[model samples]
Target chain A: MSNYSKVSEFKDGVKKGIPIGVGYLAVSFTFGIWAVEGGIPLPLVVFISLSNLTSAGQFAGTGLMLGLASYFEIGLSVFVINIRYMLMSLSLSQKLDRSTKVGQKLLFGYGITDEVFAIASTREREVTAHYMYGLILTPVIGWTLGTFMGAAVGIILPERLQVAMGIGLYAMFIAIIVPPAKHSLAILCTILISVGIMCLIKYVPFIKIGEGFALIIATVAASAVMAALAPIKDREGDAHE
Target chain B: MNKEMYYFVAAVVMALVSYIPRALPITLFTKQIRSRFIRSFLYYVPYAVLGGLTFPGIFYCTDSFWTALVGTLVALIVAFFEKSLVIVAAAAVLSVFLSGLFL
Candidate 1:
């Protein structure tokens, strides 16, 4: 692609991803304050918001951190929580420009998340470096800013309000998944299994494992089982040409 | 252990590492997705994730399975008919809170 086209693509991605960015930042703001309230450091909360950019994983991570879990435990929890994103990005790999450099592809792969993937997957042509860059920059900034703001204002917020904000993160999840669930059975099954497995982890007798390990085992076990039993077959034509 | 400081450092390190994985792929890959397995996985995976997250959200609270069950059932019923996110969450929360209060 020409330099002009690349720049424009990048600009387009930034624009498309802005809503997602705004939404993420608002939610992460809560995360930031929660981390501080939970006894985490302000700068560290900022870094987590800036770097991880995942609501569920960070929530789970901080929960574990508060419990004084071991490093191995934390690592395993994060891995399981985020393993699905790897799948999401890998699926998105097909939409990129075929001739794009492998090095660039590897570098940009880090930005794939529910919102970014949702926005970029709808693109009609091969994705460009500029497009991915645009998508990442906005959301990254939003998440970072929210976290910083949250940490700075952590003390003033009422405890009840902070707890209520946790629902915001959950609301985002519902927004991401519910619209699609109305259409697809595979997704419905996945949701069912994920919840079922998690509940089992929480209540089942011998399975009273820690949350970190429970999250890992539940995700893997559920995904693997779902993959084997209910493999999704292509039905409709590609939405974007 | 300077618990707060330890968490702060841990958050930064995790944030960086996590971003690396998320950002790297989108930057690098630019082609038509061709993998059938991955395509299928992507298509259905969202539901699994949502169910996984939501199920626990509705059920994890309360003293026993009965309260959790009642709360979640009400929430699901409300969520099914209602498009509003707030209503769905409220249904779940209110159900649980009322059950806890009355029981």
Candidate 2:
């Protein structure tokens, strides 16, 4: 780990980040159209793209907008959709440099999206501020720029095409979960429990609440149960430090 | 009362909501994790959350739940083979498009 210069490592991160950035362009393009077609102004769409890098939360926020939902509803939904980032960041914090400055930590946390979290966790060596910065740089730019272009020309796409592209987001989600779920029964159970909880909350009327609450409750319940019932033993070399 | 004002406000709020979660954990947790249970629980959060988000919602993405289900199933099968993101998404969209033609 000491052999490589930070510059080269950072460059490696940027290089690794390119494919993610390209993928972001496609998915965020769909997000852009979804927001814009829902009647949000182009500049506002651009503002959202620039300010918030979250995809699912942003999609849900747009829905809240269309429904003219209250500020509290919008806020709570975004919170619920994005609360998983907190978990991801907490998990990755184990890997970050101990001497990492607060400012750097702030930057690290700011970029803690699903893909960034996954990449940071799976990297072979310890994560540093420079590499993390490089890792997020391109994907962030790609995400924002894609949104701009999508909003600017989104009218070109037909409804059928948009609906078809909607699956792209779910495809990416499946790509992330399915591989790992195949490996571990705990993870498989977690997915099943979550889906079941969501179905129960969504389909049945009595406890059927807002989607935001349902999602948050389902996620928390499923993770808690799976973690307690089927805790994964740490593999060798999975040292905490 | 105008639509512009509402959207701008919503976007601003969304940005704040987005920033807090992403940044909070890094700022607060400067030490290593002490609890095995917490670690285990956190480990499953991503999987659980993704599953929660994908289902029910994926089924609702298209006008026809059946088409979306077929698409999601295609995505899962294709992803199991460890395909790239683009291919995964393309296979999903194609499934829905083809299904739409027949059903």
CAPRI verdict (incorrect, acceptable, medium, high) for model 2: medium
Stretches of candidate 2 off by over 4 Å are A1-41, A59-77, A95-99, A114-131, A234-241, B1-10
Off by over 4 Å in 1: A1-19, A34-44, A56-81, A95-108, A113-131, A155-163, A209-241, B1-12, B23-38, B58-103
Interface DockQ of each model: 0.29, 0.60
TM-scores across all candidates?
Answer: 0.64, 0.79
> How much is the lDDT of residue B43 in candidate 1?
46
Candidate 1 is scored at a TM of: 0.64
**Best DockQ among the predictions, by candidate number:** 2
DockQ of 1: 0.29
Q: After the best TM-score superposition of candidate 1, give how far the Cα of residue A201 lies from its true spot, in angstroms.
A: 2.4
Can you give the lDDT of residue A229 in candidate 2? 86
- Roughly what TM-score does model 2 have, to 2 decimal places? 0.79
